[model samples]
Target: TLQPDVFGLVEAARILCEDGFAVFPYTTDDLIVAERLLAAGCKVLMPWCAPIGSALGPINIMALRSMRGYFPGVPLIVDA
Candidate 1:
């Protein structure tokens, strides 16, 4: 399903929010996923700059900057 993966993340975020904990969603530069996480009450975001263990680290600097622009002062970690 086109929405299954997002649904799972949202559900998990909801559960974490319900438990009174902030969520740190790690998006693979997916705006939809990031938006869903935000809607699910995630306070911080950790978007990946590159695939895990890839020689390339942070392939998209603009994307990272854009993500940070969404929420200034919010801790947006760039996980490689």
Candidate 2:
């Protein structure tokens, strides 16, 4: 399935956050998107390590590592 618009996603997350919901957005392995989601009040980030259900584990180790480095205390669940 095609991904939703990033702007819309952030807006939705922001709204849900305002309503006191913890948002955990499933996202591509993109640091910029992760940053935006965090700013929009997402509690956790679920970044894809590979295409969904491909059984490829940790295809982008550097990206995952980068996320960890960028977000020291934030939880980053691999969404493979």
Candidate 3:
């Protein structure tokens, strides 16, 4: 029952980063969310290949590729 508060994520990440914590956000396969997380000072990104517990691997390879293209230097981990 521990769900992410998506709306407050950026601000929370910002705060954690400012306090010298490394923020690794678990994100969906969305470039915009990745961008925002990066902007908010996330050190690494954990983007899901599919919905949690779906067992479908790399469902959106294009989106993962896009994230790599957009953030070549940032570390991206495939989740779910």
For residues 1-80, write the lDDT of model 3, one tens digit per residue.
Answer: 23345658778888898898998887776777777888888979888778776676768889889888988999988776
Q: Please, what are the lDDT tens digits per residue for candidate 1 over residues 1-80?
A: 22225667788988999899987876666767787787788988778888766768769888887777776866777787
Whole-model lDDT per candidate:
0.75, 0.83, 0.79
Q: For every model shown, what is its TM-score relative to the native structure?
A: 0.77, 0.84, 0.83
* Residue 56 lDDT in candidate 1: 81
Clashes of each: 0, 0, 0
Error of 1 at 5 (Å): 5.0
Model with the higher lDDT, candidate 2 or 3: 2
lDDT of 2 by residue, 60-79 (tens): 89989989998989998877
The TM-score of candidate 3 is 0.83
Show model 2 residue runs off by greater than 4 Å: 2-5
Write down the worst ten-residue block by lDDT for model 1.
1-10
Shift of residue 3 alpha carbon in model 2, Å: 4.7
